[model samples]
Target chain A: MKPSEYDFVAARRRLEAKEKSAGEKLTSLEDAAARVTNGDVVAVGGILFSRTPMALVHAILRERRTGLTLVRNLMCQEGEFMMAVGAVERVVTAWFGIGLPWGVSKIMREHVEGGKVVYEEWSHLALGLRFRAAAMGVPFLPALTMLGSDLVAIGPMKTVIDPYTGTTLAAIPALYPDVAILHVHRADRFGNCQIDGYPHMDADIARAASTVLVTAEALIPDEEVRRHPDRTVIPGFLVDAVVPAPWGAFPHECYGLYEADFEHFDEYAAAIDARGTAGVTEFLDRHVYGPASWLESLELWGAERLARQARRAHELVPATDIMGGLSTPPKPPALGAPRQSRGAPRPPDAFTGYA
Target chain B: MTTIASPTEWLAVVASRQLRDHTTVFAGVGVPLLAAALAQATHAPNLTIVVEGGIVGPRIKPGRLPISTNEMRTAYRATMLTGITDTFLLAQRGALDVGFIGGAQIDPYGNVNTTVIGDYARPKVRLPGTGGANDIASLCRQVIIVTAHERRRFVPRVAFVTSPGWLDGAGGRERAGLRFGGVSGVVTTLGVFGFDPTTRRMRVDALHPGVTMDDVRANTGFEVLSADGIDTTAPPAADELELLRALDPERRFLG
Candidate 1:
């Protein structure tokens, strides 16, 4: 569909009607998953492996939600699993893969090739810009992405000539998903979410979607959230439900909480490689369907394994302290003769003491 | 010095040498990350490495190469932690000096195709579509492509242009309205390839140690061009190999 064809005004009206009162929005995983109807445009939060809302995805699968259009900037196992289980009808993403060590996802490749799923492509920046446009309540945003690429030729991207410069620019349409399911570091009962480390378009996705369902690792008090208001990436007004789901992004890394379960990924890769969709179904039966809750799902890996991931995560230096006391150095002058910089003096070397 | 470097190692070394000291590079996953890390460890300690996941100036740890750019390991010692949009905006605003990426296939004009192998509609391999590759290639000042050298990978024309290199050739990018930044070089397994300034077709700039022009010709699907004088790529220095091995002791990416 074209950007002009999407009803941004109606989406805004729907969001405006959602309860923005300072009341508890906390709910169970099943209850949150129920908000996502079949055939809805559900934007999955996080990029690649980090901070994926896998627990929410599993809950949706458990609820047997199908024919959903999954949208994200990047897709990994979450997209792969959903496709394997026949939940996704379409995926609007810039990239889809299992990443390195493990290469392209076998399930994604098969489904796209078989024409069972429609894989709409865009550049990573363009996808993010679409969310950005929606969040800003605009129909489209202009960008330099996908100018000469085939993505422009095939995808929904449109080009316009800039009257000011006469340069052709890509007009990225707003992507207003029906719902956005996100995994956060913490959130309060009222859905004041705080995402530590990289937010990775979650904030934009939350605002862009009409309904926002968050699965947080921890549920903090509203007092705690108010203590550091700046840390709140997604405000309570934008969120419809908050589900406390620890290890919600399991098998995937959650910043400051745990590392990705690489072994589990390897096992999943092997399973899909060996048996394709049937193998993924076996995995879902064991992990998604078999477990009673998100916590129980993590238990399938046993306490020792869970503890190891957490321990490894904690062992790494916190991002704030990684380069403590070391300031960024001034960029070295270019090899060629220096370009005129409006009469500004050359900065001193900040690396003098450190390096 | 007697150690024989693997193709990946050779590619990484050659790719790393393309990076200048103190330049900011937007590095993709796998070999691009490895090469960036290697460059930082050796000649470019001050190289500001930016991963697509919004990690800037990270001190990449040894033996713990990140599979995904968003992995916390890539966030280690990061100077700034932002989001995907903010990170790419840096490239868009011209803050990035280099964009290092890898692909499944590349055309004569250096246009990369990570999207598909055959027809986009059906019937062949559907590779992972463009991630931040197109944005990086289009926005960054210079882009370097690193991938396995094979005839299937180096095609005369890609099935789809996932990343715009030189588009059709010489003035293609300019005509396409991409004012700056086209592919600077492509570091492959057998040799280093560069674009002809006039035609913009990929040309053999240098063949790696022990690799012949015939090997490059046989491996590349396109009718390859040779520079006025093709140089032999220097073997990986002992220190370069040592540092690369230390970074990937498990040979996760090295292999």
Candidate 2:
């Protein structure tokens, strides 16, 4: 093959063309998640609160796909949402944010207690290594971290003791997910995706999965992606299906498009606080159910509807949205002072002026 | 008896204790990130917090938050640029003092299972497997296991060995002549634990204020012996809390 034809860029382009099958599109998030089978190791991408494919979570809940093993960089509220709905079998993640706002609540705790779920924690770097392994198709990379410490005791799930070195190197096997679900800011019709901000390892995850389902806020033409391929995070070849599911990210923002609807999230969290899952389910039904797009759902739950929901739920404005309590690290009062009394935190209203 | 406190306080207190002056602490993301910052702010003022991306002595503004490793901006004071593998080399060479980590499953033997919940060949769940953890766990002079302590987490045996703290026993570690540093203690929200010098298995060393040994025993899945008389961990004073908040101004670490 000619150098021009066999180059990485050309190879990528050819692969993308082959991956894009005509008439391959997801009807909805439910249909998308239903395609995944039980006992499949899946990878989903998102950071702490941004860029989560919330539509996919709704779809999984609607279809009730259970016994899934999820491998991801971070598992927070969205991961907990699956666990809460009894959809996830086991989850391996670096760090799981605890507390109510992030969805690490009674249900997640129940699953952990019931032995239905296995939680794996690691340093973020370790988490990144597994993604790199999956991306590179390596069996397992050599690692020296947590060798003699308690961390070594936890996740290496695979171990090959080196006879020569007499040192244990935890062999963290590569993860090849059945499907890698990614929600991004933009994509071409051929499923070439781009991350406007911090991509958070989604591209590597897409490479590691058997099939890739990409949901983007908007779909630009293939030519546009071709024009600036470097901006494209996922080459089209890795993608199996592309759905222009606007507001697919929902609670999570799609960078530059819209700020996270912290108010709506707050409403959802309030419902969770007041009536637990029932309230959250109702919130999901109102905002995330049906064929209507997220934009439509947001319109339906505009200021008036949310206000009514907030009043009816009898919960204060969700805590996650109202950021006025400014509890930052106190500045040194001069060069050195022991510290002032950290008594009862000042009321949120005290910083209302700042808000 | 003292009650273990919130996650933020837990991170701040651990960081305050472990970090020392002029030491180079390799920082991973999450709690380790938090602890490194706290150590730099409190005890180890000159401490160089080296991240895997190769930044050092991060000019951490006063905060209870961890700076992002992916941010090229955070790599300012870094002496060199390297991948996750190189960071472990630094640890292996005794270039590190204290390291912070968390795990999914921890056994009495301090054998962690971050890989799977079942057998190695056929796992109930395959997590994003190990990275520098194996190296950091083995090489760091002392490693601190930071995670919320629950019954499922503290198990009798880990499903897979992600990292080995004490290994089968302390004697086993000694006999094998492992160059990697052995586990010193486990810091959890509820209490702190250390391996018996002889058995190499974990024993309760201290409990956080507002927590009891009974609570620790109830939460732990294994049979853990308590220290002759365990003491309570100090609660984060105002300064500590302030420092923590500064690190994560948005309280992203709280949830």
On lDDT, the candidate that comes out on top is 1
Error of 2 at B196 (Å): 8.5
Per-prediction RMSD in angstroms? 10.0, 12.0
Question: Which tens-of-lDDT digit does each residue in A1-355 have in candidate 2?
Answer: 0122113343344444554554335345546677788876777876545567776766666666788877665565677677766677777665454322344344444456557777656555556666666677665555654434444443344556777876566555566566788887667666777765345678778876777877776565556566667777787756777766655664554433333445655666677678866775566567556436544654554544433332221121122211112221111112211122234243333221112
Per-residue CA lDDT of model 2 for B1-255, tens digit only, reads 124346656755765586678877766666777777777778778887776544456554333233334332343334453434345557767888776776778888776765545543344455445444555666777777777888989988776777776777756555434555777778887877888887777888878777887898799888898779888777777677666666666656644
Q: Is the docking of candidate 2 incorrect, acceptable, medium or high quality?
A: incorrect
Q: Which DockQ value does candidate 2 get?
A: 0.19
Say which candidate scores most in TM-score.
Answer: 1
Model 2, chain A: how large is the TM-score?
0.71
Q: State TM-scores per candidate.
A: 0.92, 0.59
